[model samples]
Target: MSVPKPIEFRGSALDDLRAFPLAARREAGHQIDRVQHGQEPDDWKPMATVGQGVKEIRIRDAAGAFRVIYVAKFADAVYVLHCFKKKTEKTSKADLDLAAKRYRDLVKELAQ
Candidate 1:
């Protein structure tokens, strides 16, 4: 197999991920590792609202539901745009907007 691509956390994603409960954080890491290796996460869904090719990794644990929004279409690395604990069934507009902003920032940064 080819070498795995590294993950680049955008905005406050890393810090946000660190805030997840231990179990949830570990699961998130495992799922992201799968994405790095060009494999699908255990659970995921397209996040077209964030951008083209963007997706969200879903992780549920005894504590709560968590999400990691990312884009892996680029060759160099998988970009993690957002990480958050989901308090309700629906993803909040603020969370969606934050991820989209981060995605746009990443694209702009890479273009420079």
Candidate 2:
């Protein structure tokens, strides 16, 4: 079998990750690594059908719950579309919209 791709973070996603506390950020990093190696962590969850091909890595700790949204398309890369601390039981529309937009942009970019 082929090897899995490495994870690449978008600007906004990187910024969101940096905003998380140290422990949370470390946890998120570990989960991303798992994805990079083609191993889905237990906390991973698929997003809605509207955001097809996207999955969120759930990170819950004493601090709070955080999410990292990403899509693995090409054999060489996993694109991180969004990262944020979830404030409610469900993801906010704004966040989903942003991720969708970014996902589109990335697809377009790769097409060229």
Candidate 3:
């Protein structure tokens, strides 16, 4: 079987991420860069699952842990979907549902 596709985050999400402060952006940048290099990068914490086609990249700050869902669209590009802070040990089913829904929406939009 062929390798699975990586979803990409374009448009607003890209703009938002690009607008993050240098430090925060750098953190994401470093992690994402590893992905570009064919690594499944993880930080100090384990990742939370948002859905089948969606996986959340976990990050932490003074506020605690949060997640960002990025879609691998190509060998070198990943499109981040949504970013939100986590309050529980496990990823909420609601978050996964939202990610799954958004993933479908993104796929449908990108196909055109």
Candidate 4:
């Protein structure tokens, strides 16, 4: 079996996570660790392609629903593109745009 890639969070994604309540943040961290270790949590779902490969980790707790967008296509790492509290049934265009932009930036950075 292949080894799992390390997970790296973008500055903006980290900032978003920092704003989460303690419980949600802790759960998200655990889920991310699972992904890093090659286990795809049952709650995770693939996002429609915008540019680079992206998937969403869905977390719902007493604090409410939270979403984490990440790309795992890189050879050496999984890049967390965005994290935010999901306030509606549908994801906002602004959030999608931000995550897509971050994914694109990470792809360019990896190529260099």
Candidate 5:
């Protein structure tokens, strides 16, 4: 079997994911693991506005809702662009902007 791709957290994504409640954190980890193994997360949607190949993984727990924005199209690794708690039905502009910035930065860095 092929090895799973490594995960590379961009910006403060890892720390933000860690800030999730225990259950939510674990669930996020599991969903990310699916991405690493070349499978889709249990709950996710395309984040085309963020960038090509970007996707958002959704997690809901007793604490509230959470999200993990990542891009796994590159062969080397899965790039997690951002992580945060969802505060409303609509995703905050701050979150989208951050993820887009990270995605752009990742692309620029990889091109070097």
Candidate 6:
């Protein structure tokens, strides 16, 4: 696939990937594949406003209920923002923070 014109990011999205091991990063590409194809889990939700025209997607991975946030419908590709292994119950506030941070960074980089 081709890279999108622009990608969105926030702290959470960055942290998710940052926290992952090298293997997880490789595996994340597969998950992104499913996301672009509308195969994300049923629990997924949008993270709302990010950049001037960017949108964030949050989803619960069916395999491990991990919380994943990323930018979708990004031109020709979906950029995986972040992925976090769940913590038993709902996702914690930290997750959101990271997502927000990623968003800011992306917006700044793109001057959005």
Candidate 2: global Cα-lDDT? 0.85
Q: On a 0 to 1 TM-score scale, where does candidate 6 land against the true structure? A: 0.54
Write one digit per residue (lDDT tens) for candidate 6, span 29-106. 555566666566334565664333333334334445455577664454455555687666756777656666765765
- List the candidate 3 regions with Cα displacement exceeding 4 Å: 1-25, 44-53, 73-76
CA lDDT of 82 in candidate 2?
A: 92
Angstrom error of the Cα, residue 76, model 4: value is 1.1
TM-score of each prediction = 0.97, 0.89, 0.60, 0.89, 0.98, 0.54
lDDT of 2 by residue, 6-92 (tens): 778876789899999999999988888788888886698787642667898899988889999998746769889999998999889
Candidate 2 residue-wise lDDT at 42: 66
Please report the TM-score between candidate 1 and the true structure.
0.97
Q: In terms of TM-score, which candidate is stronger, 1 or 3?
A: 1
Q: Give me the displacement of residue 83 in model 4, in angstroms.
A: 0.4
CA lDDT scores, all candidates in order: 0.96, 0.85, 0.60, 0.85, 0.96, 0.54
Off by over 4 Å in 5: none
True lDDT of residue 34, candidate 4:
81
Model 4 lDDT tens row, 14-84: 98998999998998899888878777866988887646467899989898999999877667988888999
Query: Order of all candidates by TM-score, from best down to worst?
Result: 5, 1, 2, 4, 3, 6
Tell me the tens digit of each residue's lDDT in model 1 across 1-112: 8799999999899999999999999999999999999999999999999999999999999998999999999989999999999989999999999999998988898899
Q: Write the per-residue lDDT of candidate 5 for residues 1-112, one digit (tens) a residue.
A: 5589999999899999999999999999999999999999999999999999999999999899999999999999999999999999999999999999999999999999
Residue-level lDDT tens digits of model 3 in 1-112: 3443354664455665665555566677777666655566586332335433445566776646656677664344565666555779977877666666666776676678
**Candidate 1 displacement at residue 2 in angstroms:** 1.7
Give the C-alpha lDDT of model 5: 0.96
Better of 3 and 5 by lDDT: 5
Q: How far is 71's C-alpha from truth in model 6 (Å)?
A: 0.8
